[model samples]
Target chain A: MQIVTNNPLVREKLQDHYAVDYAEGSFGELLVRVRDKAHLGYRLLSHPLSGSVKPNETPYKSVLISDGPGALDVESLTIIENSILTADKFPVKYPQMSAKMRADFQLIDYTLLQSAL
Target chain B: MKLELGYIDIQDIQFSEESKIANGVLYVNKDEIQKIVLGQEHIRSVEIDIARPGESVRITPVKDVIEPRVKVEGPGGIFPGVISKVGTVGSGKTHVLRGSAVVTTGQIVGFQEGIIDMAGPGADYTPFSKLNNLVLKMEPEEGLAQHEHEHALRMAGLKVATYLGELARNVQPDETQEFETYSIPEGMEKLKGLPRVAYVLMLQSQGLMHDTYVYGVDAKRSLPTIINPTEIMDGAILSGNCVSACDKNTTYHHLNNPVVMDLFDKHGKEINFVGVIITNENVYLADKERSSDWTAKLAEWLGLDGVIISQEGFGNPDTDLIMNCKKIESKNIPTVIITDEYAGRDGSSQSLADADALATAVVTGGNANELITLPKLDKVIGDVSYVERIAGGFNGNLKEDGSIVVELQAITGATNEMGFNRLSAR
Candidate 1:
C-alpha cells in the first residue's frame, strides 16, 4: 500500500498534509498511475527516470508505488488512517515546494490522490 | 407530506395452496396467480418460478424488476393512474415486501432485456441477483408488435405486483419508518443555515420502446416539472423504457432510488432538501433544449444553490445531460451529474458523447463497455438462444459450455446511474 520516492524533501513538505511512508519499487509504477489519471505532467518525469535523471532532480525521481496493504491504490485513493494524502486535486504540483537540502534523497515523493469530495 | 413505510421481510417464497405471508416467507397459490396472469388480455401465459440468494439460477431477457407494495392508508393506491385511481399519493401508510421482487422475462429482444444471475461472478454486478425474485416468464400472444409486447409485459408485471402487494396489507409489519418533509416556507426556516439542494430525476423517454411514464402520461410528451419525491415512493413514476439493462431505472429502482434516499438521509443535517424536479430525456433537439431550459428555470425558481441530476440511458441522452448541467450551472447553480461511461474494452475511448467544462462535479456509474465472462450456471430461467445478438453480446458470446462473455451493459443495473451499486472505475 505504500508509494514513495527517494526525494525526502517532497516527503518533508507533504508531511504537513500527508504522512509519506515506505515504498519498495522504482518510480515507474507511480508514473503509470499518473499517466492513467490523464495527468499530462507524468511525461515530464518519465525521461529522467531512465538513467537520465539528473542529481537531485524532479520530486518524483526514484518513486515507487503499490496499493493493497498499507495504503490506497492512488487510483481508488481510499482514505487510509495514518496516511496524509486526501482526494481529488493532485498533490501540490512539483517545483512549488522549497527544500533547504536538495541533495537529501531519502524523502518519499508527493502523492496525488485519486479524488476527494 | 409524511409517509410511514412498513417493511415485511420476506426470506423465502414457495407455492402453496393459499397465498399468504407468514414467518418471513411468502407462500403463493400457484393456480391463483397463474389465473390472474392469464387474465391479462395481451398476455398468452405466465410461468412463475422462485430464485433465492446463493442459488444456481439465471434469469435472462429480464424486462423489469418490481417490488410489490400496497397502500395501507395512503391518499391513493399504488401504481397510480395505471392501476390504482389517479389521486395524489405518497402520504400515509404503505407496506413493502422488503427482500422480494417480481422480475418479468420473456422472448424480448436480446439487446433490450437484462440478465440476472442469482449466484456467480455476474451476480456480483447486478443488484437484482440478491433479491428473492419471483420470476415471471410472461408470454405475449403471437404476432404482437415489439412495442405492444413490451407494454403487455410491463403492465402485466405491475398488475401482478399490485395483486401480490395486497397479501401483506393485513399482515402486521416487522418494522415501520416515517419520512416527513417540511413545507416550502417551513423548510427554509428549519434549515436556514444549510444550503438548498434538490434532485433532478431524468426519466428515460427516448421514443420507440424506450420510455418512462408519470401518472400514465409518457414522460417524453411532458414538460420538465416538479414532483414530491415521496410520490415516487408510491410508484407514481415507473420504467416503461426498453433501454440497456445495466443503467435502466426499473420500477424497483424508482421505488427505492438511491439518490433520493441518500438526499433524504442528508436532509436537514447539512443541506436543506427542498424538492424533486422530474425531467425527461427526449431525442428531439427542441425537446432537449426546452426540457433543460425548464429544469434550469425551476431550479432558479426554487432558489436552489445545488442540484444532483441523474440520467437514464446513454448516447442521445448524454446531450440532454450536458445541456441540463451547463444551463443549470450557467444560472449560477452548481450541479453534480451522475452518469455511466461507455469507455471501450481497452478503456481508452471517450466516456460521454457530449461534454462541457461546466460538468466539473461528476459522479460516474463506471464504464458500460467493460467486458466480463459469465461462467455457466446450473439453470437458465429463460431462453439464452438470443445471447449473441444482445446489445453487449458478440456473435460468439454464448459458448458451447453455456457460459457467456459480454459487456457489463448486458447485466441489469450493473452500472446504474442512481449509484445503486458500489461499482466505479478510477
Candidate 2:
C-alpha cells in the first residue's frame, strides 16, 4: 500500500514503513493526484473523503491506495472524481493558522490515516 | 426491553455553596466540579460558567455537550462501560436532568469544534441554545498530545455530567415517559397486522478525534449489530468524535435521539417498531463493505418492511448511507434517509458525496453551507479567536465590531441529520 498525503506528520512518521508520497499543495491538489493515480489502476484502499472534516476546510489530507497497478477500478475513479467536485464546491479559503492549530490538524490527519491502515 | 425516563425539569442553574436541586433550579458547587476535572492530570485548570437561554452569550470551540442522567432503577448504570461498569443497560428507569446540559469547551482540538450562541440569529440554528448550559472551559497541560487531550475532555464532561445526574437521584421527576422494544418473535406476534420497521443508525467513527463508543468499545471495531432502541437512551452510545460541528452527534443527541423517540411515537399505532441496527462509518473500504453487508443481512433477517436510516457527519459517511439504503431497498424494504446538505453557498452543488437511484425518499436537514451572519453578543464564554479556523468559518469571519459571519456549519446542531432541528428543505 502507498500513502498519499499533504500532511507532513503522516509523511514524516510513515516514510520508513510505507510508500509515502508527500504532496506539497492544497487538500484539493492531493485529491487530484490521487485521481491521477486511480486513472492508472491504483485501487483506492480508503475513501477519499475519510474524515468528516470538509475538503477545503482543512489544508491537509491523506489517503491510502494499492501499491501495484491493476484493472481500472471504476468505483475508485468515481469516488475520487466526486470528491474533487465536492472539494471544489466549498469556497477556497486557506486561512492562516497558528503553529499549534497546524499541529492539531496534522495529528488528526495522521490519526485518521492510521485508523484505515 | 423497556426503559422508563423520568425527567426532572431544570429551569435555571446557579453556583452555590452546596450542590442540590430545588424548585426546578439546579444549584451546583463549583469547587466539586473543579476537583473532578482536575483529577485528570493532563488538565491544568477548569472554569465553570453558566449560559442560560436568551442570554447574549456565545460559546466557541465547544467540544461535547452532555445531558446529565442517572440510572434510577436499572440493572446497569448510565454510560455503561465508560463511567459505570460494563453491563447491559436499557431496562428499568433512568432519570434525566432535562433543560440542562454540560457544555465542554477549551483550546481547539481540531478545526471541527463549533459555536453555540445563546441568543441571536445564530441561536436559531443550534438546539443547545435553548438549554441551560453548564459550560466548562478547560485548559489542558502544555505539550499534551491531541489524542490524550480529547480523551481528557471527553472524560471530564462525562464525569461531571454523571455527578450532576446523581443530584436528581432522590428528587422527584417532573415528567416520566416510558419506551419499550420487544424480541423479534414477540413483536411479530403482537403487531402482526402492522408493518415492521427498523432504524439504521450510522455512527461517526473515522479516527482518534472522530470516534463513537458503544458500551465503551470503539464503534469502528464493531460490526453492524441489533440493539434495543432504549439502550441508546440509557447512554449505550457515546460521541467521542470531533467531526464537523453542525452534524456531529453529541452525547446529548444520543441520550435523547429524536429518531428513536419519533419512531416510538408511531410504534404499534402506525407500524411495528422492531429494533435499532447500529453501524459505524469506518475509513477502510473493507470495513465499510463488511458493516453495510451485515446491516442489510440483519434487516432482511428481521423481515423489516420499512427502515429509517440516519447518517452522522457527511462525505465518506454519505457512501455508507447510500450503501445501506440501496442494499436494504434491494431487499424490497423501503427506506427514508435523513441527512443534511453541503450544497455550497449558492445551494447549487450536490448535497451528498454519494447517491443512488434507490435512495428516493429523503428528509433533508437544510444546507450546512448556507451562510449566516451573527450579530455580536454581550458576552463571549470561550475564546472567539478560533472562529477563523473552524469548519464553517473563513478568514476575516470575526469583524472588528465583534459580529461574525459564517456558514450554518459552524453552529452546533445547525443541521442535525437526526431531524433534531427545524431546518429542512422544501
Q: Which residues of candidate 2, in runs, are more than 4 Å off?
A: B108-112
Best by DockQ: 2
Q: Model 2's lDDT to the true fold?
A: 0.90
Tens digits of lDDT, candidate 2, B1-426: 998899999999999999999999999999999999999769999989999999999998888999999999979999999999999999999999999999999774646568999998899889999999999999999888878888999999999999999999999999999998788899988888999999999999988878999999999889899889998998999999766889999999998899999999999899999999999999998888889899999999999999999999979999899999999999999999999999988898899998899999999988999999999999998888778777888898889998999999988888998989756663
The candidate that wins on TM-score is 2
Docking quality tier of model 2: medium
Ten-residue region with minimum lDDT total, candidate 2 chain B: B105-114
**lDDT tens per residue, model 2, A5-82:** 999999889999999999799888899999999999999999988888877767889999999999999999988998
Task: At residue A49, give the lDDT of candidate 1.
Answer: 24
Candidate 2 fnat reads: 0.81
lDDT of 1: 0.73
Interface RMSD of 2: 1.2
Cα RMSD (Å) per model? Answer: 18.3, 1.3
DockQ values for all predictions?
0.01, 0.79
Clash pairs (backbone) in predicted model 2: none
